[model samples]
Target: MRLSTYEIILPLVGTDEKPIEGYTLLTNGLYGAVDVVPKEDADKLQAGDFAGLPAALRERLMLRGHITRKDEAGELADLKLLSRIFKTIQGRSGVGLVIMPTYDCNFRCPYCFEQHRLKKGQDWLDNTMSDEMIETVFDALKDYRARGYMVNGCSFYGGEPFLAKNLGVVKKIADKCREMDLSMGAITNGYDLETYLDFIEEYKLRSLQVTVDGTAELNDRRRLHKDGLPTYDRILRNVELALQRGVRVNLRVNVGKENLHGMKDLIDDLKARGFIAKEEERAKEEEELRKTDPQAKTKRGQFSYYFKATTDDAHPEKNISEQDTIDEMMKIGFTAEEAVARQSQYNMIWNRMKNLFKKEGYPDFSPAYCGAEMGMLVVDPFGKVFSCWDVVGKDDQATGYIQPGMSRFLWNFNKAKWRTRTVDLIPACQSCPYAFICRGGCASRSSNAYDDYFREFCGEIREIFAFTASRLAGQEWEKRRAAAAAGEASMDACAGELTLSLAGPASRFTEAERAKIMETNSQKEMFDIVKGAAFFPEPE
Candidate 1:
């Protein structure tokens, strides 16, 4: 039997600052099942000598089909595996669909990527999705349903989705989704949310991805009205109302060098305004939501926050490196280590890794990073269809268009082009450990930056992993120290759970309680052991 090419060994360290006897082995190439083997067995398997390993361990490795039989042929090639992923993606239902009501946006953020597209007179207003385009969208949805596929939901994307002018288009799409029994979401700037609150409530919007870079002063410099008026207070008020009305708000903070220091103040202000309310406050809100919105699963607890590193634009004046932003965050309050580590912990890469791990049992794998390749088609104002929102307004990126008297879209080569792109096509991604999570990152970003479909920002990805690993290693050290007190030399029982808990979900605790969980490990160690022990009830 031969080891899978995708299997990787990550060294684990114990209390003595030395490598633990065993390594943590993870498999990726198979496109099915995730196996984690302890170090001793991994060592034996690595040497092609599994004689001393436990029967169950060997049987599992064999059962998972990662290990190839000497009598049978070896594992499938990358190209073959990729083909399977593509076919799998094509067959799936509840695929995500995004529609841009209008290219017009109220806020003019400095780093807006669309600015470049708009600079050459893109004619955003005239390009808004029309009634005819909405009919074409319904036609597409009906076609999908006939093909035995249901859309997960519709997302309203825009220069700003909640614009007063776009309300008709938004309502039309939402009405169609309701008729088809689908959920809905939006990526709005929040400036016009108050105007759309009734529409949001009527459709029971699942979530809103809103940007609030920092406080009013810092944010106004970037996200401003075309009239150059400040929108901070109004946006915040709308955000609070959304949460109170049971809509989960994913507050996106676009971090850069200029606005890095404003983050602490933003957090403080959010807390003070009851935007980031206490548990009791959240509980009260949820209780009210239960009566008014039984269909809404967006509880107060799910109103989360995220930090996105601002992407570089043609305008170098606004460009800032992630490291610079991290350093500035450290200056504000976070420790030098935490400033770097937090970015990784909360990054999309890490989130995708966690989801990939969950897929071991769930098996809900996504062939592409998003729905762009398989099921999703972005319909712009003029009935132009694109693969992603990033390329919605670009004429060259349009895959097809909704023409009169057409059963399907008028043919475009790019449709087939994006659908066929998988890890196998990119030599760099084929061998990279994070390939499954990144899916070669954003294709548009790669093409624009490298002028190659296969090239990606591998360096930034590696740095993020480095920061996460370093922080995890520090946690391992604390686990060892705690295990030492219990006269245990190994982390087999409680230590593994304690170390993994950090990655599982964020838990709320008082400052003193958090100290115990992090420093002493008394509370966390006990909690992990009990939770792990009783994960499943004893057989009756």
Candidate 2:
């Protein structure tokens, strides 16, 4: 079955003629799937919008404004600043380093992209970055700094970011960055988040993300230990601790077929735990007070939030009944972890939110999911640069290097003739409307000289995009019952759904281009696939 769940908020909530615009998300729970949909006005939609939608599900929509996908040369809104700083500092959009302290993982998730990298086998008891090697990365960073710009802050990526034994060295690297580092963040699996809560709080991490695939059964099924055993108990325990510790968690979920039905389960669980609601009245007040008084004593705030951390002045009145469930969950010894994870359960169809902004006079429509354009970079602990782990080190995934004593390696770049050959470049993606935003997708999926399987891989992505678009357009009129809370608005432009079509200026091709290119051309096919990947479920 298909679900076109959307998150929308219109100012004219009380009016019978409320306007609607934004993208929608289409989910295929059968496959634990998700994808982006195009935007449509509330008035533009036909009565068919309500065809298959159940009445109880209509009022839970969550909507948001759009973000930018253009260069940062001119001053833009603060939200675009995230991407602007990335390109400005690194001469590209995504130049932050994603240093994996280690490849060793404690658990095994079925869908993990790095499953081939193995969860264990590497001796964690001694495997770690040495002081000398750590300095090598830092020394190389100087070259990045010389490139002129504070690349996106450092990214700690790994089997589990905190599980790396060199936690102390990672700390030192962060400290050194104080003189030139932009900011620091992480994408951990949430296994050791509690044990390392101090690092999160101490660094005041910009975004410390953790992934939990689904509710207990599905989550355990998708994400588990090396022995194929469930790890729900410990992971949840850690999440509980992290939440109580005051560290904001970017809970990540990669929905797939097996966990499709778990959506409501997770949402219900979080609501019951209060982890998704405002903190106790006291906690909400403390959160407000903390803004002015850093020295204020630790007091629980009145509210805890599970809303999108955005620049938009939009807040939906959380479900009142949902709030009550949280109160109940707390009484039985269930920790805030359930709430934290559950908060992410709301099936937000980004299309509605994006369409909302489009109707609000959005200025630009650059598609920006995440990448390393020039100003942005993803650095590995070993000092190598990549767009992101999902896009680097493949046979076709290498751009440049920030070597210790080197001026820097431009690897292979010549924009004017960037595609003299088809294999080295994707002749199909240049013309994509989402091209600028997706940057030819990931480098590994290139078909020309990059990967022999580029076509097949990208073909799969295109299929996903097509599925999402239909859903968003199909649900044009259905309205949710909730209203925007307070204080969440923004000024960024809305880029509609990034389709997987080969239509932008990037699609031109030479007659013999295919014959001249090598089979290992990696960057070619990967670009288009990732643009539409905003909805891609990560490996469990």
Could you say which candidate leads in TM-score? 1
Writing each residue's lDDT as its tens digit, candidate 1 over 1-540 gives: 766554444554343435545455344433434444576777788788865778877765765544545221223243233334334433344556777887888877778878755664546454666677677777877776787677667888977878977787789878878888888899999998998888887788989988888998988987878889988899888887887677878888888767766778887888788765653566666677779777544344346665667775565566566666666666777764455434633354444444443333222234355566566777776778887777777788788887645555664998887766665456666655555545566776677678864465453655555444434443444565577778776544432222121111112233454333334424335355334434212445
Best by lDDT: 1
> Residue-wise lDDT of candidate 2 within 1-540, one digit each (tens)?
111211121221112222233544432211112223333433222233633333333321111111112222211222222222222222332345667665566776655556545533565323555566566666666676675535557777765668735578667766756556457777777766666777766775666676666577877876786677777667666766766555555665555434544555765776676655644554566667779997563422122224221111121121123223333334444443343223332212224223432333222223232333333455544455555466433423544454544545345452222222211134443333222223344333343324542331232233323322343323322312121122232211112222222112111323233222222233334223332332222445
Instruction: Please identify model 1 stretches exceeding 4 Å from their true place.
Output: 1-3, 12-79, 82-86, 89-94, 120-124, 278-280, 283-302, 315-367, 404-407, 454-459, 465-540
Single out the weakest 10-residue window by summed lDDT for candidate 2.
Answer: 310-319
How does model 2 fare in lDDT?
Answer: 0.43
* Candidate 1 similarity to native, TM-score: 0.74
Candidate 2, after superposition: displacement of residue 384 in Å?
3.0
